[model samples]
Target chain A: MIIAVASGKGGTGKTTVAVNLARSLAGPVHLFDCDVEEPNANLFLHGAVERTDEVTLPVPAVDAAKCNGCNECGRLCQYHAIASFGSQALVFSELCHGCGGCMLVCPRGAITETPRRIGVLETARSGDITIVTGRIDVGVAFAPPLIRAVKGRIGSGVTAILDAPPGTSCPVIATVTGADAVILVTEPTPFGLHDLTLAVETVRELGVPFGVVVNRVGMGDGRVHAYCAKEGIPVLLDIPDDRRIAEAYSSGRLLVEALPEYRTLFTGLWQAVGELAAKKGRATEVAR
Target chain B: MKIACTTTGNGLQSPVDPRFGRAQRLIIVDTDTDAFTVVDNAAGAAAAQGAGIQAAEAVVRAGAVALISGHIGPKAFRALRASGVKMYTTDAPTVEEAVKRFKAGSLTEAKSADVNGHW
Candidate 1:
């Protein structure tokens, strides 16, 4: 079964809930930090990175020698990535979607698909827990592609947990989709509540079963609880505001490892998730 | 010289649209003859990404040597400037007023983009 931990707003404990849940769960479990823009779960696990592979996107490269500038490729490009002027075709790699339409439409065979390194997918292991992370190169604007690259490593029969990127944008959608269940981590603040509404709408539109995990419980008001109750959404767990947890997190220590008592909490949270997914009939034939 | 002014309506009476990428229409008018053509900018306005760059390309293709708008984003600014298309900004009440300002040399040319594109 695959479970995705997501949050609408940043710094809402998505990585905390995801890493802890993956570590606490019994049997072989894989954790994918799908927040390619910034993957931090590896910091908590401190596992030696076993393997890494460069992730690349196909971008159009223009060949000046092969060209008669028909302007067909430039006109056909929806992205305006290929601009031809006075027998010269300029290919802006950053804007190319790698759709390959430019290459196909080019009458002179001037456009060729080229691989551009966008990010790297790395694997690490801490005992039975395997962590997969996508680390995007600096200045890369798109994260959905790298997120997909990390999620492609999902092994069958192993409980795969994904810590998704924040917000209701494309990257979050890519991570949250195909999950047996989704756990939305949020704080109790007003900003959290507002963003949570957007996230809930996104998952609901995708027709996925999901629940909420309130973090830093004592930091804000009860409006989040009120909103969830009004919407009939389940509040699976709440991690209280504790300075010790913060200090441990800052120093790159897992909550379950630093505070032995919280191990039970994460394990119980996993149990709740299994039950929730099972009830929704999404947890199919996955022996836990 | 042809100048393109972002407009709210098809005619010169229409208000000058401040937004460069999301403008409704681009009225390309010849400064010498006052002959003009209106290009629908809805496609760029509705584009998912690179709206500013696409609009800049449209301006370039329209044979407009200059652009008049409220703001020019970095992407469009770079493209227009690269193509030697000078850009001017105005809060003129109508497209006609903006063109008049352009003819009077009262409109200030934008040296660089005022804002970054959202996408």
Candidate 2:
């Protein structure tokens, strides 16, 4: 089963939940940190990454010598990153979407695509679990490509747990899309509740089966639980405000390692996710 | 030269908001002659697929030589710059105030918005 762990707000223990769940879950597991911008799961897991791959994007390089300034490349580009008119063409690398439209429309074949290094994908093994992650280079505008690279490393027969980035944006979509189920981790505060609402809407729109995991549960108000109940979304697991868990997190330690008792809780969480996926299959069959 | 002032809503001299993608209106002003025309940007929302480029094209088609706004992203900036339109960035709260600042030569070219935060 492919289960995606996501959060609406940053620093809400989404990674903590994901890492621990992978550690506790039985059978072969692949833990993919799809949060390419800043992947922190490696920091907590003590393991050797066996493989790494570079992720690149195709960027247009204009050869100005052979080009007549037809401006067709510019007109064809939806991004407007290129402009060719009156014997001069300028290309902005930052705004280039790597669509290759400019090269396709270039009458002189002056635009050639060159690989621009955007990020790297790393794969590591920790006993039974295989962790694959993407790390985007600083100053790169896109994350979806890197996120896809990480997800592509999934091997067969492994229960994949994807740790998605925060918020309802492109990166988040790339991580959660096509997963069997999603576990949205959120706190109980107003900001958490507000962003969770947006995230709920996003996942619902995608028609994915999802449940809520309330982290730092006792610290904030009980409004998150209230909202979940009202919306008919199940609160799958609740990790209370514990000082030991906080310390373990700050020192780059998995919660299951620090607190072995939490392993059973995570195992139960995984079971619950499996149940949800089974229910989704039944519902889809009934609809069909 | 007619200039487009990025605005929060579709009206004459509306407040010049910072958000480019969510801006409700693209207020077109004749900087040279002091005439006004408001273009509704309700159809072209920000960060949506192809919306930023479309909005830039709409502004350029309106014959605006320049764009005045609080912040512009790399995508929108590239779209406008490719069309030979200059952009003046400022934190002015109102469109009228921004035009006044532009006329007085007080507004400076805006930079890309900070992408670090959870916006």
Candidate 3:
């Protein structure tokens, strides 16, 4: 069963829940850090890198020699990545979405795809817990392609926890698309509640079964809880605002490892997630 | 010499648009004939990305030798430079005023992009 941990607001404990849940689970679990822009789960896990693979996107490359500038490729390119007025087509490689529509529309067959390295995937093992981190190279604007690359490494028949990027944008959608269940982490603050509403809408629109995990509780008001109750959404678990957790997280330590007491909390959270997924019939066979 | 001015409306008296990539309309004025034509730029304004590149292409295709705008992004700057089109910045309120400033050499030619992309 695959579960994606996501939050609309940054620093809302999606990674904390994802990594801790992956570590606390009893059986073999894979944690895929789909936040390719910046993968920080590895920092907390400190797992040794087992393998590294480069990720590439197939961007179009034009051949000027084939010679008739019909401008069909230019018209077909929605991104304006390729434009031809009366001469050879000008290709803006960075702007290309790699849709291959231009290549298909080219009557002269002058356009071909070439791989452009965008990011790298690192597979690491921390004891029985396997962590796959997708790290995009600096200045890479798009993250969905790299996020898809990370999800492609999902281990079969094992519980996979995807630590999604923040916001309800394309990257978050890419991460939470096919999950058995999604854990929307949030704090109790006004900012958290506002973004959480958007995140809830996003998941609901995608038709994915999701539950909320309120982090840093005891600081903000109970509006989040009230909102969830009114919407009939389950509040899976709540992690209180403790300075100790913050200090441990700051020093690159997992919460469950730093305070073994929290292992029970994460494990219980996992169990609740399994039950939630099972109730939704998303993971009947794999919910444990 | 023909020059393109980013504007809010179709007429020469229309206010000059501050944005280059998402300008509402482009007014192409012929210095020799004192005649002009308007090109609607709604497509570039609505583009998700590469709006500047597309706008630049449109200006080039309209046979403009120079561009007058409040700001130019790096991508558009490079594109216009490659096409041998000179870019100048104008604080003039209207397209006709901007053309007058361009003819009087009161406007500064941009050596590099004045603003970052998506600004």
Candidate 4:
């Protein structure tokens, strides 16, 4: 089962939940930190990354010498990353979506695709868990491509847990899309409840099954609980606001390691997720 | 001088709202006359693929010699500069406020909004 752990707002302990959950799961599991922009799950786990691969995007490189600038390439380019006027063909590297549309339409074959390094994918293993993390290049604009690159390394049959980026944006969507189940982590605050609604909407729109995990549970009011109950969404787990958990997190330690008793809780969470997946499969089978 | 405003919708007051699809409509305001004209972004094709050059082309065709927006991404900023279109970055509450700031020469042009990272 591929379970995605996501939050609508940053700093809501999404990574903490993800790391502990993966560590506590029985048998072999894979953990993917799909938040390419600033992946922090590795910082907490400190797994020895075994391999690294560079992710590249196809960008048009204009060969000006052979080109009669009829602007056909530019006209065909939906991205307008390439423009030809008179004798010159200009390529704006930043605007290019690497769609290769310009290369396909270049009548003079003036435009050819060259790989532009955008990010790197790192893979590591710790006992039963394999961790895949993506780090975006220092000056890249897009994250979806890198997120996809990291996810592509996922091996089959391992229960993968994706630590998704914050917010209900494209990056979050890219990470959580098509997962077997999603765990929406949120605090009990008003902002948390509001953002959780947005995230719930996004996941629902994708037709994915999801449940809520309330982090720092006792710190704020019961707004999140109220909202979840009203929406008929399951409140899967609650990690109470504990000073020991805070210290563990600040020191870059997994909660299960700090409080070994909590391992059973994560195990229970895993069981719940398995049951949910099984139910989904049965429902789909019924439809067929 | 006709300055173009990048808007989220067809109105004269929206910022670069990401919620709106890439079909950017250019709001052209004649500085001297204070009259507004909305131009269907000629570069809508660029936005279909979320390209910056197409956005720049839309603003340029709308007769804007300069652009004022909340945030301009790197690709779009480069395209705007290449086309010799002046850009101003401001978190103006409304489109009219942005135009006013541009007219008063109080808005500052900014670097691109794309966060640099390894791809």
Candidate 5:
């Protein structure tokens, strides 16, 4: 089963829930950090990076010699990254989405795709748990491709927990698209509630089975719980505001490792996730 | 010489558009013929990135020899400069006035882009 931990707002404890769940789960489990923009799960994991791979995107390189002043590529480009200027086709690599449509439509065979380094994928192991992360090179805007690259390392037969980027944007969608279940981590604050509504809508639109894990629960209003109850959304787990937890997080310690007392909490959360996913699977099976 | 002025409409009385990349329309006028053609630049206005470059492409494709706008970005400047197109910054209210100033040599010559990209 693949469980993606996501949050609409930043600093809402997505990585916290994902890492702890991975540690608490029994049997073979892999952790894939799909937040290519700012991957921090490795900082709290007990592992040295064993393998490194470069991530690249295919950007177009135009040959002016073999070109007629055809404007097809520029017209077909959705991002407007390609522009045909007289005899030259100007391609801005940063703006390219790597769709390769520009090269395919070039009638003169003048457009060739060249690889540009956008990020790196690193793999590390902490005992039985394997951790993979995508780290985008600073100043690169394209992250969904790299996020997809990191998720490609998922091995079958092992539970994969994906730590998705914050918000319900393209990157988050890419991460949570195929998950068996999604855990939306949220605080109970007003901002968290507002963004959680958006995140919930995204997951609902993607047709994924999801439940809420309310962090810093005791500190805020009960509106989140009330909202969840009203919508009949499952509240999977509630982590209270604790200074010890904060200190553990600040010191880059995994919750399962730093506080053995909370192991049962996460382990129980996994059980809840299994039940939720199983229920959804049966529902889909029955419908089909 | 053909001159391109960023404008809100197709005619000479159209208001000068302040933005080069996101300009609504560009009026390419031939000083010799006193004739003009309109090129829609709204595609650049809606572009996610490299709007300036795309807008520059539009003017270049129109065979414009000079460009008049309130502001030009670095990428647009580089693209126009590569085509040897003269750029002038103008506060003229209308496309007609901008073209008149271009001929009178009163508009400031934009030797470099006056603003950063996405400005």
Candidate 6:
């Protein structure tokens, strides 16, 4: 079972819920931090580095010697990463999406793909739990490609928990696309409610089964709960506003580790997720 | 020598657009003959990414050796620089005024991108 923890707005406790859940779950559980822009799950789940891999994208390099300026590559390229103006083609590798469309359309066969390093992926082991983290190099504009690289490390038959990046953009979509169930983490504030609506729409559009985990529940208004109730969305867990939890988070401590009493709460969350996923799986099977 | 000025309208009297990559239109002027033609930049203006690069290519395609605009972004500057096109920053109100300033060497040559990428 794959469970992706996501939030539409930043600073909504996605990493908090994801790390704690990974710690509470029994058996083999792999946690993949798909937030390549700024991965922070390793700060809480420190482990021995087992493997490292560099992430790269294939960007085009043009050869001027064999070139006739046909302008076909420029017209075909939507991003305008490469263009020819009655002369040699100009290639801006940073703007390239690695689609290879230009190479295919190049009649002179002058364009060749070259690997450009974009980020790094690391696999670390914390006790029995495996943590895979991806961090994109600075000035790299996109994150979905790197996020996909992180998701590639998932081992089969292991319960996987993905810590997704914030916002309902391409990065978030890339993280949550294949999950069995997604945990939409949000606080009870107005901002949370607004972005939760967007996230709910995103998950619904993707036809994925999801539930809400209200973090810092006591501080904000009840509109989040009310919105969930009106939409028939399940509220799986409610973590109250507690200074001890904040302090634990500040010191890079997992909630289950810092406050052993809350282990049951997270364990129960896993149970609820399992039941919901199982039910949805059966429903999908029946539909198919 | 041909010069391209990012503009908001089609004619010489049109105000010079502050943006380089996402400018509304580009007015190319032949400094020798005083003849000018307007090139619509709707495609670059609506581009999701690399608008500056596309706009710079458009200017190069028009055979403009120099560009006059309010602010040039890094990517646009790189693209223009690769084509050996000089970029100039202008505070002139109209396209005609910008061209006059360019001809008189009153406009400041942009040694580097005045603004960061994605501006």
Q: Backbone clashes per model, in order?
A: 0, 2, 0, 16, 0, 0
Would you give me the overall lDDT of model 6?
0.91
Segments in model 5 whose C-alpha atoms lie over 4 Å from true places: B7-19, B23-43, B61-63, B81-84, B89-101, B104-115
Candidate number that wins on lDDT, 3 or 6: 6
Rank list by lDDT: 6, 5, 3, 1, 2, 4
Clashing pairs in 6: none
Which has the greatest lDDT? Answer: 6
Candidate 1 stretches greater than 4 Å from native: A280-288, B1-52, B64-119
True contacts kept of each: 0.25, 0.10, 0.35, 0.20, 0.35, 0.50
Write candidate 4's Cα lDDT for A16-107 as tens digits: 98999988976888999998888999888888999998889999888878777777877887655688533457787766778888888877
DockQ for all candidate structures vs. native = 0.25, 0.13, 0.42, 0.18, 0.43, 0.52
Tens-place lDDT per residue, model 1, B16-117, is 988998888899999999888999988888976678777887898899989999988877777777678899988899999999999999999999898767
Model 5 lDDT per residue over A118-144, tens place: 999999999778999999999888789
lDDT of 3 at A108: 87
Better of 1 and 5 by DockQ: 5
CAPRI quality of model 2? incorrect
lDDT of 2 by residue, A1-288 (tens): 789999889988899999999888766788999988889888888769898889988888888786776879868776656765334466766567788898888888898998888988898988888889899999788899888888888766568999999999899999999888999999999999998999999999888899999999889898999999999999999998999999999999889989887888898998889988887788779999
Which CAPRI tier for candidate 6?
medium
Maximum-TM-score candidate: 6
RMSD of 6: 2.4
TM-score for each prediction?
0.78, 0.73, 0.88, 0.75, 0.88, 0.92
Q: Is candidate 4 or candidate 6 better by lDDT?
A: 6
Residue range A6-67, candidate 1, lDDT tens digits: 99999999999998998898788899999998899999998899999999999888787887
lDDT of 6 by residue, A1-288 (tens): 999999998898999999999989777689999999989898999978899999999988889897787878989988778987556788878888899999999998999999999999999999778999999999998898899999988878779999999999899999999899999999999999999999999999988899999999899899999999999999999998999999999999999999998899898999889987897799888999
Q: Alpha-carbon error at B24 in model 6, in Å?
A: 3.7
Give the TM-score (vs. native) of candidate 2.
0.73
Query: Which rank order by TM-score, best down to worst?
Result: 6, 5, 3, 1, 4, 2
